[model samples]
Target: VITGARYPRLRRSGWICFGSWLAIAIWLAIVSPDGSSTKDARVKNCHVGGPEKYQRYVLGALLPEVDQFMLGFRLITSVDPLFTGEQASSLSNLTKTIYTDLESDPDFHALGSVMPGAYDELWARKFDHGHYFLYVPPGLDHKSPAPALVFLHGSGGNFKAYTWLLSRVADECGMVLISPSYGMGNWDSQGGVRAVEAALDDAGKDIPIDMNRIHLAGLSNGGLGVSRVAASDQGKRFRSLTFLSGVCDAAAIATDAFKKQWSGKPVLIITGTDDDRVPLNHVSSYASSMRDSGAGVEMSTYDGADHFLFFSHRDRCLEELSRWFTRQLAPALPSSKELKGQ
Candidate 1:
């Protein structure tokens, strides 16, 4: 009797609840530690509370799924130091860039719908001790024996968004995409190398991966890991290596051991001219050393771009990568004598 009769105040004032919620929303929109106005206050709140704070805004957005996906990426980078020894706050500029792009680009709103099953597929499968994300392109099966691209992520926690983004390349090039995750993204360690190998082995068992056509690629700190893995005894398994906004170890690349392993293999270095974290000169020097050591080196540099170019310049980057894979898989030309019926 007390439960039903004593709640008269709650039942009589529905407007009170709505008014309280409205007040809370107004306070969140107008207040911040920086003491700025509405938009600036929200931006400052994002910086103070991390990208998770963006969730409140995302809930009110038109494309919640795409906003959520972008939020996941911002959260990951906000917690880890992607610039090797730098602090997580070093990604502030990148976060701002993402926010700007999302507001201005209408096409970006449709990113989540591009690959139908990408989001669910990435989260559904767990392999190699739950350290990898595997994606098999549509129309590919055990009968096709498609090539594989093993991608390594940079420092920060690994999330499905990366595999989702790279799935475009896999779809276009008709290749299987395997992304292996290492704790805090320490891919330069033996454990990291083992994780990659384990993922490849496990994926190979379930899919038709052309062992000889495997390619290795990494981003940011992952680029350093790529060098480590390519220099190991397992190095001979990869046909090509790609680095995106990554720095190569100067001492390691100069050594005879590393040169011997990657000598004839194709190396692609994609970087930004204004990348202060991983300077253009450093990457250029690494490319020169690899080329001098007899490795087939290709360098692609973008002007006025920074370390976060992978996200900002996504389309061009994917196109270049897909083209590179096609070049690698192209059949050799027939000899002139054979053409002449000799």
Candidate 2:
């Protein structure tokens, strides 16, 4: 967890790095390399002065004009996550509110801030000596419940590393994405589990999250973490489980009682035949053990794919995974309302 001590250094370096990248990307959209432009050159000639001055125009009055120009054009397809029409407008307004809240709220500033983005994809905040990064789908209904996923990253991964793909998934699936940073620790450790729980609670407070649809997912060490968490009593709360490149020791965690409890719940295990780090045999064996114990488990395999196959087969994986997740979701129950402290 980044506290008051490390927070400043991270904020200074992290936000600035992200802000610098954002300013450059946005600036490139407003200006051409040859300095030949038809529209007013207010933003084209403006100099970037760190995060606070990122929006300053040649003339103060031109800022709104630049905003309009940006809103009007589709500068870059990858950087611009917002959709067209009313959805884009709603997301823009929500983004503004989130930014203002992060900047003006003393509690938020002292805790953490949003990860800067041309579209503001994610936010980073401290939790249990670790950090929890979150993304809410643009144009999410505040009054209606939306599904949420708690994603655990592998040993060498961080929140920023996976936010791009996860953000896209959240937008497509209408799910809230919560990724907890374990700071080099394995996710099954006591601290790791607590951090994940903290992340869920924090994300729930920020949006009208549907607890009934809450799902737990992980990759690599994260996949191992999912197995451990799902075997515990607390796992009963989740509607489903998705494992990517994950293998676990069935004897150590998946006891008879655990299998009995998970028998009715859905479990989707995705693996690659060519993943040497986690062999297909290990994952298949674990799945077999869970099935023998009466758990509802499904396994999917990709050919000619390695440990990093998800990166290569992203679209296919997301489409199938999204379908699996959608099928496992349960209708909002009365108890789900309590998850939001309503």
Candidate 3:
């Protein structure tokens, strides 16, 4: 747990602060000075900014970052449920799983959330006091173009949860990925959908995005959010919809507009058989609704996976998603004709 370089990085007070900032950066990534993994977004701006200008890369900070989990775990362990010794142990294991998944964060790493890497990750403001983070794929001499995947995370989750996966996955799939910090247990219908729409509109404005190839994916609670959004008038914007352990029955809480609007786009559903939290049965329930409504859908089931299958099997989950994106979202520069809308 020692984090000193034997000598200070600089003599100037400002630069010394900058060096300390680097330590903060490493610490924020959950890279233990003792032991941890480096499966996060590829980092180009490793050093902290200096005298010329000081800008903090606090994208994850505003939403879900390693630091939030670090603080949250301590809070979770001390909270109401884990009062007894046995319960504490179980809670400890659960927290450990969360840490493992975050350390191996798929979106940040897979999406290439860092500078001079493969892509650019940012945020777009929305009404209802909410905002959406953006992920734009890399460019060669500032002219490269690629497809995009807009993902939404479930309750008790934020953008950091997917940043690692998206960073790397974006590279492999040639897709830009974006997600917003909609808040835990609070799925703001209008806000969440608006954020996604804003991202798509922004991408379409420049760097070339295939409108026909646009797609939406969500997990757990977020699954419910996007599904509802897709079932609305705006849903037609995407070529397909993916529900991964989501609460597809958005009308119960969020909105019924989703039911009224039938993008009729292709659908892909994945559920973990052993998910104790949401259960594979829930997704099946949605499939029943879709089938009853004559909404075409395809489904896949994972064995021995938990409610957090996306985090538990990030590499595999993202690989499957990348393949799906490739089929659904044609690369922008490849052909405007390929875009169903363009």
Candidate 4:
């Protein structure tokens, strides 16, 4: 048993265990240090033996014993770097520059280049009703296609906010990150849907983006807004969603449309047990709805996080976000039709 449990029921079967590790391996691939995806890049080969070995295991065995490998490495390696003000400041600066340029571009491309050696491209998208801030990878300038990640800001949040977090992510995974600034109405169900649908339309034409891998993520009010949008028009274009410090109860959002649009997609809900505004009850309600509806749902509760879960626990939230997204977006599995998910 990975946990060395005394009860046999605590142990997972070989197939389930392998599947779990495969999930972790995908997580690692997404979060690996710079250059981790380059063919033969050797900085972190934590995928059991190697990608080759894992591939062989998956092909031959009912399930390759991947869980033990993932569990073993995760247990020993400190996944997050030590917290430091200097690193945070640098990251903050890098992110701000990315968002700042998107809204008001001056062609000073060096803004996103702060994360040296990573490929990047910036765009100012037209939303018809308004304009949006966007970014994508120019990928080694090498004809390779890439997937897209759209970021939604919470209530009182804007496009530039996640610049820091998303920039780090973009560098780590070579992903295209689009952070759409929602001026004042981001939380409004109608407005939320408009911003997301526009962002998706913007990315679709601007880059060689893989439509199948699109994901929605937000913290606080933005999270709730995303749930509503995912339920309505945007659901058809997306595969899954992530909610941080928010949920889908209409009573919570003060809207009936959102209440009705709650359960059409695979959802990942994250909340701090200490959250005062939304509380664990709301999170439980939302998660229960998805699960009871047979949607591929997941939730995680941190012991002392609050309404601003992302600010207090950036590393953990981002880690889980990447982990959950990798599991849902990776190319290994057949798409789930259970929820007719977006």
Score each candidate by Cα lDDT.
Answer: 0.67, 0.60, 0.56, 0.53
TM-score of 1: 0.65
Sliding window of 10 residues with minimal summed lDDT for model 1: 40-49
Off by over 4 Å in 1: 1-130, 335-342
Model 4, residue 114: distance off in Å is: 20
Candidate 4, clashing residue pairs? Answer: 154-222, 159-181, 238-342, 239-342
Could you tell which candidate, 3 or 4, scores higher by TM-score?
A: 3
> Which pairs in model 1 have colliding backbones?
none
Best by lDDT: 1
Off by over 4 Å in 4: 1-129, 137-142, 249-265, 333-342
State candidate 4's TM-score.
Answer: 0.55
Candidate 4 residue-wise lDDT, 119-158, digit = tens: 0111222212333335544342324556667777664334
RMSD of each: 12.3, 16.6, 10.9, 21.6
lDDT of 4 at 167: 53
Clashes of each: 0, 2, 26, 4
Ordered by TM-score, highest first, the candidates read 1, 3, 2, 4
lDDT-sorted candidate list, best first: 1, 2, 3, 4
Per-candidate TM equals 0.65, 0.59, 0.62, 0.55
Maximum-TM-score candidate: 1
